[model samples]
Target: MAPTRQMSRPEESTLDLGEFTLKYRGDALPQPELLVIGKRSGRHKAVHTFVNILDNDGNLVRQAAITPDIASFIFGSFEVRGSTEAFNIYESDLVVGKWSPRTRTNVSPDLVRHQRTIAEQSFTATGGKLAHHWPIFQKLKETGFGSIIRATLTLHQLCSSNCPFCSTILRNKRDSVSLTEAQAFVSTLYNEQAALNRNEFVRYNEEYRRLTGTDIRLKGLILSGGGQPNLWPHFSEFVRWLGELDLDVGLITNGFPPKIAEDVYERFKWVRLSITPESASPFYPDGRFDRQYIPASLRHNDSLTVGLSYVYGPWTDDDMLKRLDASAHENGFRYVRLLTDCNLTRQAQLKAHQDLADRLFRLGFIDEVGKPLSRIFHQLKYHGSQREAEELWSDGQCKLQSYNVFWDTTGHEENGYSHCYPCDSVTVLADEQGETDISVSERRFNADKWGTVKSTEVHRLFTEPLQPFFDPRDICASCLFMNNNRAVSDLVKRASYGDMNLDTSLEHLNFP
Candidate 1:
């Protein structure tokens, strides 16, 4: 019989209200140069300030100092009463401007028109498979080209953790994608467009060039799966293969085996370690488990960027946050991204957490704050936080339809999984036997055993209409990605229509 694994208890702590203490360790750590605050209520004010730090050539330098006065004022102003709040600090240029929780103004009209055009064309092209293809079109339009910019390779279907909030963990099984199949897929992507006979590749590039006059190419790869990618038997070979293709690779793992830490440093661009409040205890001193994980050599490798992804919520309190921050700084992590739980019913809790997280993130009161946070920091980052039917509809349109593609080793069309919307640039899937297969369904992996890897087949499957499989309108009613996309799409539409107010007190714009 297989040995049973022990499970940790869920973290349960209230929000930390008086943990607003901020201190500078010394010149060894980077300092913030700009402060951005999004005031949801109270005075309805916005604050954006840039510290005086520039070289002779006018380039931003890292010598900026945050005096006690400046730091106090920045933190003080961020403590405002509001349902929605956002606070961000930057080490370089200030990018925070007056933002409205109810309204936003940075939308580009041309981009909106371009996105709309692609949406219409995709609807007509796929005879209505817009839902499945919206993510693809959206990504293409974002890059202004037809080349596959990024692809996610789901390496295996095995994991050790059983986090209730994880979709992949619940579906975990003892299987992995065949190394040969993985190499074949990579070869297909590495070959020149002309060398391949896929009509979709040809037509996508042709349309993109015709519209923008630039060629498309794949640039990035994500190594992720149901289980820890480093656990895969051929992880090193796969990393080497991706390096050979000249694609920037990123890894998502639970940080085990320790050896892959050094191996990934030599080839991958970045590695993100997923941590949870309950599971994080093992890596602490009392657990004596750190010796089994990443070593100091790998952590301090300057060439290899490292970061952490932590799921935050009511159960994660100030104590945990402080511990996480210290761990990141001591271990040489570039950043710690706070993620909300994936359970869709926690909308209220998620929003509340977002507000608290914004405050914590802005004050640099919790965790190390060195660079501007991702957009997900200011808004909902996953579908699990979505609520309201109208939030799923955007101007009665699906703006990002046909924007990306996803596959598993099984090559099945669906993986029996449901998300707010299809957001992956492309996914590679594996079957029960650890072999790749062609899949047809978006929410689940419905395998097409007879499907081939030809370009035409790839294009047809990727560009297929959504109506035949599911009603686009009904399926989107609860999608979390729709609202986020719509928010950005509306911004672009308004900007194009000359309806945006560009004059606001918050000066500076930079998204890291």
Candidate 2:
């Protein structure tokens, strides 16, 4: 297991609303620049425009905007209210404005939505998947926000390996869950999966069309488990199910084999590449877990979007530079190509670490240095409260901020790690060309598996306001703890945890 990193100073964020607080970046500039915009809620119209604003502090600053025909609040403002977040726009003290009504009759609906700043619309042509995708083209439909929306025909997805580079490999079979234990775990997992799948994880496939009158399609699905995905026996079947969706399907897996890689690549447009081997070490599976890697044809220049994850350890070496060289190559992937690492060695191992960091920094190779790298990259992908596994989500920590959501199989407390979630899940993104994309997801726990939604109520219990909450699995994974420091052979504990106090005993790992 890797060392469990602790929150610096045991001081919650400087701005403590309660037990929950916002840790200042400790930046000299502790304020955010404020932006103000005017709205158009003209007279003689029934439309009611809302007033709100945000200041240097995260608190909502007050303002008003009203216009004719279209009535709404200023964008990026008006985040706080009563009833609920989505509505509460104008119930009281609302402001109004009047301006010329404009229309882009020549532009497409998706582009028009982009201009309106709607949450998500990836079915557009040119900038995204082929225009033929989604309920696009003929007449794109919109599903209004609802109390209960979505229905996922759930399935179980798997990790390909038992011992992945970033996860806990186990103390052995005895150290890991037995077949009976795993089955029980699955039972609990399914119960929760069902509830969540029905709630927010809607499906709009052929079967889905038969299931409902509204066009609110399935939003998010998982192809991973408590263990490595590839190792899951029913993986191929799950892939086939995803293909049947004919809509956007998502997957989170350690890039181990080219088989799953190729299949997912050919089918889905996005993926997360978690592991990038650094130094060669005997402690690993005879360097098999620690040596270097050479991914096949990174220079494709295809439409595929990839997130690169790099974890650093006290042992990280020159492998990062090599990967960077390949990634930046002509045929390399169009990626938010991320790299971050951790050094899990004792003081002795770190002796040469700083020197190497300096050298790499000089060579523009500082990315392969430590937790900070993964933290930044992961922040770019996920919005989970407990994100930032090591100092980063080297790819697992490297979640999809854009078009994604977080789902935990275990109903645990939010990991008090510092990481950012910059995804389009709740918002929308439009490039210079007016191509836009959006994603809506649930922060499910212990329901990452597919087969069935085990305990839907588990979502409500963890004391989190995540939507479509569900139950949890019986057996849990130590890797989820990821606070291991007494790692032995082939047990490549990830750096995301933290400094392994070499002084601790194996029994202190809190493992069975």
Candidate 3:
């Protein structure tokens, strides 16, 4: 098939306070007429759109509903229109709308105030001032050793399935944190308030309570690791100990070993099953239990929220989506999360799958209102636009240098240390003795070190600026997680400041 042709000359206008660039062919339209700008394919295979609208001033007096067919258009010709308010018609940010001419502007002061209040509250609660105080070392300060809200317990490093896309397959060693170590880690975080001053601790705790309606020191415990968490030898004991802490527990697993279904259903508040075609194959000629185990296990656990996670690539298509949806419906899975492969080699494949995923979302095959699914889609779109804007607006600062914390088994018998690095680009190594350690380069920069569970490192990391271990620009340049986090932080900063030009960088703002 022949490709679509581009316009020789196109009229253009800026929308959403210049967040989106809109171009149309032919003459400009008159004012008070609604203009709909939909996406289209531009020259050099770029994604562009066409503009048209329902004319309430003339014969068509009703608001036209945007369907998937209108939204999926690559590009088309239209006459430019007058300056007016653009109504964003979208579902979970997947379908973005350019500015449309409107008769009257829809402004809600209460909604604006509410949004700003939420942004300010989140910024303040999550150590907002720390980012401004030492912008370079902000991420490091926020994610100090024990300061992390969600703690992931690596029960053991062992899995039955050999999924090709699994990051765990890269690790050469297998090990798990002992029950004693896990207990110590949780206990330390629970009792250790030495890092923060009394007043600061009180304020943080109060803010957390107000935000989450919980007075617990930590948010929740996540039972996850490079391997299958349920395959650990002491899975039940670990779950019981975490329950004793009086905190919610979450599990991420391949949904194997149907024996532990009751325990998991009773103990875990939420569980995510990493489902893939190979793992959930229907052609179980060998009568392997993996195929039937997940559905059978989850059939009775209606109270426990079950989410299905799938990594989409070039192989994913409409048929696969239908199969996935059918499986979710049959297994009583309440939510489905389709994710793109992060490996750079699969970028093209990822893009293919992303386009397909967007189409599937627009077609209503996937649940739009489900938690994490819609949220992740919005984040994907927002980050994409944010990255494009960064080319023109960024000041070469890293927004996620020290934002979140991650801990893995160091294979050290004496101590299990938490590696403090940007969550986006993590590189761990093993010493001559095969014990897990941070890479040598990271160690040289003091980015990797031994952090005891009881250490006051968490408090100090949040309140005080640590010595710079690495350049933020070099490390965080291509990190998607850092970019997304920074984008969110920037949004909060912009909203709180009431800045109309959100495209500009706000790294210098201290949020006093």
lDDT of 1 by residue, 1-512 (tens): 22122223221111112212122212222332222211211111111122223222222233234443434333433333111111222222232322212211221212111111221221112122222222235434443323333456666665554342343322324335667766755554445432331344565455544443433434456677556788788988778777876566777776566555566556867777776434323342343222336745558678866766676543344565666666677778766665554332222224434444455665565333322232122123333212443454433444443233334443222332212223331111110111011121121222232112222233332333421223324443434444435543443333232233432221110000
Q: Quick one: best TM-score, which candidate?
A: 3
Superpose all Cα atoms of candidate 2 onto the true structure and report the RMSD in Å to 1 decimal.
23.4
For candidate 3, lDDT tens digit of each residue in 1-512? 22233334333322221112233322332211112222211111111122123233211122332232332221221112111111112222223433233332222222111111222222122233333322222222343322344456655556565442344333323445667766766665455532342344454455445544544244556676556788877787778767776576777886566556465456777777776544223233343323456544466467666766676543344565666666667667665565544332112222324354455666565343321232122112111223433552254433343333344553432344433333312332111111111111111112343232222244443454433344434333334344345444553343232222321232212221
Which stretches of candidate 2 lie above 4 Å from their native place? 1-214, 256-264, 276-301, 327-331, 336-361, 365-512
Supply the TM-score for candidate 1.
0.52
The CA lDDT of each predicted structure is 0.39, 0.27, 0.39
Q: Whole-model lDDT, candidate 1? A: 0.39
How well does candidate 3 score on lDDT at residue 301? 66
* Root-mean-square deviation per candidate: 17.6, 23.4, 17.7
* Poorest 10 consecutive residues by lDDT, candidate 2: 427-436
Query: Lowest summed lDDT over 10 consecutive residues: which window, candidate 1?
Result: 429-438
TM match of model 3 to true structure? 0.54
Error of 3 at 157 (Å): 2.1
lDDT of 2 at 399: 15
Better of 2 and 3 by lDDT: 3
